[model samples]
Target: MSDLTDLLTVPVLDRSLQGALKAALNGKAKPPGALGRVEELALRLGLIQGRLIPSAARPVLLVFAGDHGLTRSGVAAFPSGVTVAMVDTLLAGRASANAFARVVGAEVRVIDAGVAADLSGRTGLVQAKVAPGTEDASVEPAMTLAQAEIALLAGARVADEAIADGANLIALGEMGIGNSASAALLMHRLAPAPLGDCVGEGAGHSPEGMARKRAVLAQAAARSVATAPLEVLTQFGGYEIAMMAGALLAAARAGVPVLVDGFIGTAAALLAVRLAPNARDYCLFAHASAEAGHRLMLEVLEARPLLQLDMRLGEGTGALLAVPLVQVACALLSEVAELADVLEAAG
Candidate 1:
């Protein structure tokens, strides 16, 4: 595992970034300040990125797909095969994320972290398989520490490669049928709350499914409480969630801004924050999702999301939608005129 302290040393803000934002805000035009959240977002982006001219280029949307053994325990409404099918749909450019990425001019990269089904010879997918599937959480641990480390490293490596490939902005998304259960489990362990509070209906589960999910997660939490955070992750969290957390850490270290999507994404951000508290500096909450646990996760992270469209589509759709808003913020900050530049002296 990489040294968490060393990874956390990246600068989150600098004078150049702040100065550029101030200059943009002071440009001649409307009132001293007219654009509210937009201007704030621009400045915040600059500060977090430590860049005078903040521009997200070659934005990459990383969708990590995996399957949880807990899915077989009747946690999710959808079957485990849905994960593989969705991965295929996403790769075929038929998913919501693909559509949004096409509309926003961003590239999408799908990684097969630990799909239970075979995806051999799949095109347009990055095969970084860590395991066939997570271990059955209802019976034993989800994954060994070694497996978890491998998955996390794969995610970090992907972020590094994306940066090398000219991707200046990163968005985290996931595709696992029972991931919300894993997320809730992680949240219950990491946050200062009860498991019931963190638990939610994942993938449109019914009341009974949610109840069973909570019960199973409670048991898993009890069994893993004695372990460290990473240990708990290896034992109970899904591979995609672990990878998403690693990606967030890598993005922070590489000085790239990160946009977080809904519950699954927020859960990863929460883990990232725990692993590297400074990583929070580079993260931007894209939106408030419709998922019940997502709001709690966002609250725990103390994030002010850009939109509240009540979206729960995961797949980084919310982040993709927020991309244009971020760009508009930058434009307003850089191009909009200040009163001084537009109004003549009192004469």
Candidate 2:
């Protein structure tokens, strides 16, 4: 057994401050819960931070980039090389995630979890490649169990480093061709949903292409009966997915809140929550992805996403878009005056 599993124990959030946090939010100048989900957000942040006052200072978005050998099995519409291209775009600060990070005052770092091409020596990218890319799951396990363990540990360390660098909040994203296929497979086995329900037109596919994708995924499913979290990950998960799962576990262990992006990110969260249920307490769903099976995945996780712009693009773009809301939620709790104070001042 890998030591990574032993290190994944996430203690439940200390809810001892829940009542006081709720009281503080209720006593804010506006009517109780007027901020709607924003109030809920503040409460969650307060609970995670263990104080009435919470902070979103130094928000960091870690975009894990990898490639999937499943692409060779005709599972994706784009070539695997796009993963490397997008990594370049992100490192050049020209990706959608980077642009959103700039507007919301967050930092973006791309991690090369398992891109097929050699990406070492990149100035801004973090090096944590588990393999060039996973093997085709339609033919064999996506990666060895050992490789999966390494990827999980790599993700945990990446997140820990961000927290050490003053990141009060972590927003997760991913860049990988055919990862939606990997996510769909992970969801199929872990969510235990029907394979058809988990399959979607990832990156846009034609009718024949979609059929081919479904067939390929069915083949992958038939190849394995492993439903355990780590087993499922080894059987079907991409390195980026495994790493995101690790990042979530590490963030929960550190008591830092995480902004989970769309379908792929949620799949990673599902794997993490399965490994350590307490990790769910630290995850805030960023948006409802337009992918076919995402709603069901969110249902299984019992998460309410903050936004739903029909977004399915991966790259932590949705997570970065939610950063301002998190900051506002923190500010409302830490800076807004109480109703009693307002009444006293008026009197």
Q: Considering every candidate listed, which one attains the maximal TM-score?
A: 2
lDDT of each candidate versus the true structure = 0.82, 0.92
Clashing pairs in 2: none
lDDT tens digits, residue span 240-338, model 1 = 998888888888887788999988899888887877777887899999988877777788888989999978878999999888887776666556655
Q: What would the per-residue lDDT of candidate 2 be over residues 1-347, giving only the tens digit for each residue?
A: 13685648898799999999888899989999888999999999999988789999899999999999899999999999999999999999998888899999999989999999999788998999999999999999999989999999999999999999999999999999999999999999888799899998878999999999999999999999999999999999999999999998888888899999999999999999988988899999999999999999999999999999898888998998889999999999888988999999999
Residue 292, candidate 1: Cα error in Å is: 1.4
Query: What is candidate 1's local distance difference test score?
Result: 0.82
TM-score for model 1? 0.93
TM for every model, in the order presented, reads 0.93, 0.98
Error of 1 at 134 (Å): 0.8
Worst 10 residues of 1 by lDDT: 1-10
| Candidate 1, residue 301: how far the Cα is off, in Å | 1.0
* Cα lDDT, model 2, residue 287: 93
